[model samples]
Target: MHPLADTYGRRFPYLRLSVIPACNFRCTYCLPHGYRADPNAAGPLSLDEIARLLRGFTRLGMRKLRITGGEPSLRRDLTDILRTAASVPGVERLAMTTNGSLLTKRLDAWADAGLNAINVSVDTLDATAFAALTGHDRLSDILEGVDRAVERGLTVKLNAVLLRGVNDDQLPAWLDYLRTHRVGVRFIELMQTGDNLDYFRRHHVRAELLEQRLRDAGWTALPRAADAGPAREYLHPDYAGRVGIIAPYSKDFCAGCNRLRVTATGDLRLCLFGEFGIPLRALLQRDEQIDDLVRAIGGQIGRKEKGHFLHEGRTGITPHLASTGG
Candidate 1:
């Protein structure tokens, strides 16, 4: 099988496909308050288009598939998408990253469709604080979904974006809650994605500080196998769960980056922080050879930016995180 490798020799076996770019909530660090979906913009990839792309990637040795979105559960044909992805011949794992607001009722359906793992975004457990941060009072529903995912025996992970004065203090509670359960919790550092520049600058907490806190609490590094995902895992001897950090801004997390991002609109993103993308959706309809299309994608993969543009003192790209699978 042909492996998807970049110029830097990073094999791109993982594909993060955004099924939809419209989400239900507006978390402070992600979407701006009162954000509305831009109706006039072109729609996301159709189901057929998504399947074809996944198949294409599979031929290039993509074994791990992850579906992300504004909220992946909100997609009307989520189950069909999941099944199609899982049916890909060599796809060994199918997973999703969702906000959990719409997951309580769909968790079972998702798992049955070959979903092997799930990562839910829950910044705070406090109801009022959750509502304040997300501009929604769906905290109960979310946590209930999290619990239901656990009960179903699905591999579960909780992602909490750590904001210095906001929910960073909840780390201990997050760890305590994970003790008996096998669910892992990852504390993400707030990123300077588009539109939330000021908020990111003001509230962003360093992952190092949180890691130090974990060490102080007696959390020890758990040796991970080579194929582990982005999170750097740690744990206390007595806890069944693990704690992790996904820090994009703290340092160069781009080296050995082995994933390719497909924006909701079917644009192939070479790098998360770069706007240069090959428009795969537009090319799908052309009567061209699939190999030619794949070759063009390979060219861009070789040109993947060396790092987040911030390395050169640039700000977020033109597109919003809601539009990309960030």
Candidate 2:
């Protein structure tokens, strides 16, 4: 099988596929006004289309597949999607990112369907702050779900967007929880999107500060895996859990990019903040179109920009995180 590589010698072995566009929470940094469906937008891809897409990706050396969404759990057929991903040849890891609202109720079924790892968005440990940030008062339930996932033997991680004067000062709280959780909690730097200029200016925090704090507390930097996502992880002898920092604005941030993204409607995005997407739904419609799908992906990989223009204050067409499953 031909590996998916770019002109700069970066090989992509990870695929982040969005299965749905609708999310339930209204996170302050993401969908602050809640999700508003676009009347003219096409619905999400069908199961058959998803299967073909997965097969095509697997044929091109994709070893890791992450099912993302505005909230992946909202998809009624998510279990089938997970099963299909697991059935695909060459897919070594099958994971998903969710808001964790439905994890407690549906995690076991998802695990049975082949989901082995999960990343849940938990902005804060404080219940009131969580409600204020996510427009949801389900922190307790979500935490319970996290515990359940750990008990069920699934590799679990938590994502929290770092916002100044918001959840930024909660590192101590996170450290306290990490002392026993045995999970990884990544603090993602708030990004500037097309519609969040004002909010970005108000709350964006550099992840470097957090990393330094971790270092001061005796956290040792861990070596990154070849197919891992863009998180710099740290480990501490006193803690069972790990700390991860995702700083998109850091120098040479895109140099190690090893993943590609596909939207819910089957559009390939070379970069999270890219100016446009290449439509791939037509090729995904039939099993016989796998070759064309593979070619389309392989062909586009060469034209991927060396890096995103985010540092230049350009967010491209990404209006919000939800639009691209962040």
Cα lDDT, all candidates: 0.80, 0.94
Best TM-score among the predictions, by candidate number = 2
Structure candidate 2, residue pairs in collision = none
Candidate 2, 208-312: lDDT as tens digits? 999999999899999999999999999999999999999999999999999999999999999999998999999987788999999999899988999999889
Candidate 1 residue lDDT tens string, 118-204:
998888878898998888899889888888888888889988888888888887677678888788998887777667767877997
TM-score of each: 0.94, 0.99
lDDT of 2: 0.94
How displaced is residue 162 in candidate 1, in Å?
0.7
Model 1 poorest ten-residue lDDT run: 310-319
